[model samples]
Target: MGLFNRIKEPIFLKESSNAEIQIEKLKALKPLLNPEGQNIIEQDIKHLEYGIVGEKNIAFELKNSHMTMYILHDVYLEDGDISAQIDYLVFTKKICFVIECKNLYGDIEINSAGDFIRTTDFRGRKKKEGIYSPLTQNQRHLELMKKLKVDNKNNILTKFVVGKYFEDNYKSVVVLANPKTILNAKFAKKEVKEKVIRADQLVKYIKNMYEQSKEIGVSDERLLEWAQSFLELQKEMLKDYTDKYEQYKIYKDKAVKSIQKIIPTVEDKKATTIIVKLPVEETEIFKELKAYRLNKSREENIKPYFIYNDKQLKDLISKMPRNNDELQAVAGFGELKINKYGNDILKIMSKY
Candidate 1:
């Protein structure tokens, strides 16, 4: 949901008024309250208090003082559908910024390709697993904002991963359990500047956006439609996995793995696509991937066909071979592997 949706609506708007009554009814009902979700909401509420420190009027006047932020939670912009109900939509006179919040835990790394990987310490044994990258979703949100033709001045739309337990390995605009540690690290590394917004500032910015969106007569019709469509798509996507814990876990992990995994620009320019089958013993797939490339000449297709282990399948999707010549250049490409995995390799290409 966008940031502005969280605030109480203008008591006058007919739709908003009815929505408010429904929300109140839900609150009054006993079975509907989600205990765990409520706890997180409480924490977020507390953090928000600290995030917005300055007065509304003064914040607007100061340059770099108040960044109008619209708070959106669990928003999904899928197939042109907007995901969450907007928390609020903030429109500063100049630019509109959207803040999408995901309440999560652990340390995360978002690669240049926009893949999200989270690191966890389970019983002190560290492990890493891929998850949905917020960067990809944020970009989709930006596209929605553009479709909405929100004031063009809002050039920067950023995503935040908030939780009490994220490791501060890298400096970012992350809200963690230790605000002082984050600040100190920023200053000590001389990397501490304006990139990070304090919690109070975050709240103030969101509030500012909410008020401004109201003044600008922002409409949520399109956004709501987008939200409903996104929800449906999510259900469809999740249907492939079985409900069994072990069975579904693999799908869950892979579904997250696909997030931000494919970059269309890189795939578009490929002149060749090669499909290869790797030897079973080798450890590093990319090394073998590179070796396959070294032996091939430039005249061939830019795409590579790989019939390697199941582990290497996802990587190949992003590196799809452009043509038959490139497909033949892969590590274990032969008449046998080609005939056996040919259709499978073509299937991967079709996805992009």
Candidate 2:
């Protein structure tokens, strides 16, 4: 039944993304902020634009694949406090692919240990840094999907059967959406190399996997039903991407108002000088935190951003977390990270 009743082309159940909405929101809020705040917003807009272009590239490939498939873009799922913002979910008759898209501006290398390293050239110098593995990230999404499916079963036997089926059927893929990116994965493990591929190779990769699978293909109707089951599990994400910018705008406005009231009239002989402190980026604590990150990166032979990015650093400064428990409140600081660098970070924050 599956051989004769296959889908002719890709059918997109949910095609839109929230990234476009975020870009519009940031642009509207940019004019209201000060110079520093405006600069931050500009950087965010550029990042979002790059991501949008990458997703579109993937969409174009799937649209022109001429294969039987169901595609969902920008799916958000939550299991209790944990959440995943998946880039693409491609469903076939025999397998479902959970894809993570990276539109990076540099070359990528995968070592034998499965470590992801990115190298970029500035002027005549080459800078190399380790990046968080997209494969690992996509694997987490797959695990969440498996748990959700297994938990839905009422009996223990049914749960066990469902878990094993999900493990065999679901696949995780990391797609580099940047066409110009140079990938060097020769020394990587066989499994790691197969899971990572360029955007242009996505169609061929899926077809190859489909052909190798021994599982029987379902009809087009069954395929749609399988895809729709996941679509029904999608939840509305409550995260506000523009929240920090809004807070910065409020802080800038208050500073301006305070300066206005303190200014003296022309009749006054001595002019009052009210000095407003610069933004957090220019403070001594910020510099020290950056220095610590660089030193720690060197010590661990990893990228500085892997420990914490610039935005996360600023969050630490603003929140001034004094212990491991408080540090957990910051984004990206999981149990492993807190246990690894939590004490040192707390010590640094104690100085100021």
Candidate 3:
């Protein structure tokens, strides 16, 4: 079968090696637990079972996309100390879609800050609680994937050339797996509604998105190769988490991007290093800068490059600002930009 080859039925958590692995752990714990400990384990098992059911529900609904895309379920990816489990990852060569499934039920309200509020019935007693934000949960997945590169193309490529794909990559979704749930986020941003959708709306959303994504221009073989690489990474992560028997690591503090490789060429018995300014595009920094612009543009419904043009991008990269005062030297980055993105630009530069 091809990497995306479909079986008579979908390959979901029910078919996952990790599922079997997890089940065995449950079995092994059975004989050793006292009643109180068993109760705690049972609750953990219940949550696990519920999560798998959500994943299975979404996987089945995604079948209409099998012929055109690759569907992955129960993906666990570890980034350094952090373990990220994705319920469903659907993608084509040019476009990657992430859906974080929430098996939650009740009336859901999302505030502008992206906090989740759940209010529902418990034998008519009316219960309410706050759940962690799925938007942020899926955002972590998108960020980690964007950070992965065969090589840092940002050091040599144009943003539109290397980054158009990254811009689309962040457009992820959060699916409420239950049809009984009601979304009451009247104050949710327009972008939030665009991303978070109901289960029944998912198929139509993917089909529409796939249609729009048809122009990606990557070949089947290369695209398949790219996808397979991501899958290979996931397989490694599965073993990584399982053996971790120490327990999964929670990321409380954000880790800044570290410089993993440095670029230099030898000349006349000396090493000549090429400096990189990652905040400007049309230059080596173009891809990162361009993706940033695209993200900002989508948020405000403005043109992607409305902040700066090609010449300005080239100039900004060359200026290589290291701080607020230095940023003022880059063309088009006036006081407003210096105030708004100065810190962020410096941080991105620090990583390179």
Candidate 4:
């Protein structure tokens, strides 16, 4: 059994645009509520405060821009037993930014295997610690979006988001909202950089996305309407640390989780649809990936095959592993290579 017990109604925690106002409201209501209710509210506020700060940092940067993007904050949704807690969902006609905010004030580093390490400078003494990867956490949100038909296939993003015809693709991003903190995930490949960024880089990163996606366009008015409908349709669910720990500790996928893990781009799906008789290594994408690997291998002074040979790269192209475990399942991908270069390979494959 799970740690959560169900009553008649689950008092889903409230999400707020203005954290200060909501915090005050909760404080005012504390004395009038039951002990349990009050405890839940307190926990929500305690945890959400940090996240909201980070989100607002991103928002403040976006506010000055004239770009046609809709920004939604604290989107807590529920569907049966599953829930998705999103910090910021910034949407344009062409792309959706599913941003996970990290409000850490420190130097941070994440290896290719997705191990996260942070060093906080406090009183001139640096304290270092390892934490779970937020990249993995944001991936769950993307899956939830896919399941809800908000991403990928169907465009009925929310019941209340009327017209019921808006659609865009998702790109998972982990944002470190403290500019003072230094982040070095440079060990990752070219494509992986877009997924992780510091606060100062957030606006520029978004602008880059806008530049790339300007071809698929939506008007500013329609985008704002969609944003409003999203805000109205948001059904509060568990989004706090205590709540996640108590329930949904694992992101459960009932069916073939392998196919679900694949984050194929529109181009990739199109490429797969075409039947090519060429050997897997001779395929256009496979060769591009091989060339990419050869360049990296030479820089590291290792054999190109050490990264992945023609056959191994072909296997990767065919299987399209989205995560470390799936990549490990492919032939010739041992634990060492999976830890060292699995993410880059996955990122490359997901694109095409």
Candidate 5:
């Protein structure tokens, strides 16, 4: 039965993604936002689109692999307060694979200590930065799956055996979905190298793992049943994709109101005049800020506006946020941006 199943082509049990919906929602909200807010929303949409394309690349490979497997895309699982949004789950006759898809934009290097560093080159300059480990992320997803499986067993013996079986049969893989990313894993541990691979290498990697497994293969029916058991654990996420943009709109509105109070508009019968003035020293700070933005944008190989547009840059200079908490109070500096560039921004402001 197992041999017969192994000859069949792979099938996807779940493939639809909510990212498309989120993108559409963002597009609808973009026009309603101010110029600065619109820029930030556009960046969010592009990031989500890249993620969708990466997942689709992986999907295309799985559909064409001709191996016997059941695949699930975008499986959201929750166990009490702990939740995981897994990119893919593949069930073969002998093993279940938990995959984490990364559609990164730069060359990646894995050190002997298991740190993942990303390097991006723009023109002649190259910048290196540490990125979160997809391998570690996938391991957490696998751990959740293992705990759920073990807890489902009726007896202590069955629970222990299930836990042990899971450790042996379940595998975690980090697939780099971007075709152009160069992965340097030679310095990494053997275990780390084994867990990460390019999108094109995924099918071959799965086949190798399947062939090496000592567990007996099951029939297509049993394989589907096993896959279904895990599928049943998937929880429908009720996330409001527009929440952040809505908050941005509120912040923009408040900012506009605050500015209106500071610089009142005067109306006359034939003419209306509004006077605006800024400190002379702000000119130097603006130059420093723009230069910093340009350098950072080049290093990341992204548009300068993606970091912060002229309006947001002026806002930053006006607020002169001293720390992460103060930076968050500014309209465009979210947690991600704060964590990535906050300290550098503060240091520059400190000099002034």
Candidate 6:
């Protein structure tokens, strides 16, 4: 009948092309979303699955103090984070769990390296990237729970990687069937626990943890402040990367421009024009550019601009042979860079 009903009885729900199309549309909109936007949309999907599939009862626990919640969440100790903030916390009598909500799509694969990959269909092409390592992040949450001194040992403390429900999309929550699946995948486990549960059973523990934490103590403003700081730190770390990227771009442009003037070019400008991508994140491209520039006989006629990643390369690929603005986008190709190596890049490109 409906999507929710279909989950309860997958056979009867009737998979339609319309549902699949709707899910694809949602995926398209994911990138435009902010963190909060992304999180909410994901939660909506999970609830839809629960409604349709008759999921296990998930008890989440968080205190709404002054319209804010301070949640003791599952975390990874290796990443060294305190706890994650959660919205829904249900406390039931039997089981306990700290729910960590993730809005994701595709089958997740955990390998021997202790790394995780999320499978996504990018333009109908399957692509995977290393994402939130549940083992690492959740363990940190466990440690934080212990630090909080909650009587949770008597209760079950489990972590879940909830997959967001996309209408007609095959988004399934996959947890390693057992702890052995992870450890024998050859990664060391910080703690030895019995079997790891997935699907409905994980929800049961979440409900239990929520209920148990409620009896311990309600989270206070101090806890909220601490969570805020942690989130901020994550943002700050991201900002640092962005700033470095920007700096590299600015300097790279200047280097290219300076090279254009100094490097002697052939009369056939069109044939001489070529674009070479610079390496990013400690790759060989940086060294190659430097070495080539050093040995050039007519180094004055060459200009070189730096490029970091494929995305950066894609942007400049269209504007080959260096424009002022495009050159600016290259990191480390600053005015001094232009004065020194701009002609060198031009000379190299001219050879092509």
Candidate 4: clashing pairs of residues: none
lDDT of 3 by residue, 1-352 (tens): 3533443233332236355456556656544555655566567667767767776777768774443565667676544444567777766555667888888868999888777899989887888899888888898887776655423345655544555557664358999888788988779888886788888888788767767874654665565665566675563222211122212222211111111235455555555554432322233356677677678778888765555555555555544667877676564565655676677777766654
Candidate 4 per-residue lDDT over residues 195-312, each given as its tens digit: 8898778778877876776345655455555456556546532211222222222332211111322344675563243322344445556767878888998899977766666555
Off by over 4 Å in 1: 1-84, 150-352
Worst 10 residues of 5 by lDDT: 253-262
Model 2 regions lying over 4 Å from their true place: 1-6, 250-352
Q: How big is the positional error of residue 108 in model 3, measured in Å on the Cα after superposition? A: 1.4
Any runs in candidate 6 off by more than 4 Å, and if so which? 1-137, 140-195, 199-204, 210-215, 219-223, 236-352
Give the lDDT of residue 103 in candidate 5.
98
Better of 1 and 3 by TM-score: 3
What's the candidate order when arranged by decreasing TM-score?
2, 5, 3, 4, 1, 6
| lDDT for position 275 in model 3 | 42
Q: Mark the 10 consecutive residues where model 2 has the least summed lDDT.
A: 252-261
What's the TM-score of every candidate structure? Answer: 0.29, 0.70, 0.60, 0.51, 0.69, 0.28
Residue pairs clashing, model 2: none
User: In candidate 3, which residue pairs clash?
Assistant: 159-287, 281-286
Prediction 1 global C-alpha lDDT = 0.36
lDDT of 5: 0.80
**lDDT of all predictions, in order shown?**
0.36, 0.83, 0.62, 0.63, 0.80, 0.35
Model 1 earns a TM-score of: 0.29
Candidate 3 RMSD computed on C-alpha atoms after optimal superposition onto the true structure: 17.8
lDDT of 5 by residue, 160-191 (tens): 89987787888999999999999999999999
Worst 10 residues of 3 by lDDT: 251-260
Q: What is the lDDT of residue 209 in candidate 5?
A: 95
The candidate that wins on TM-score is 2
Error of 4 at 6 (Å): 44
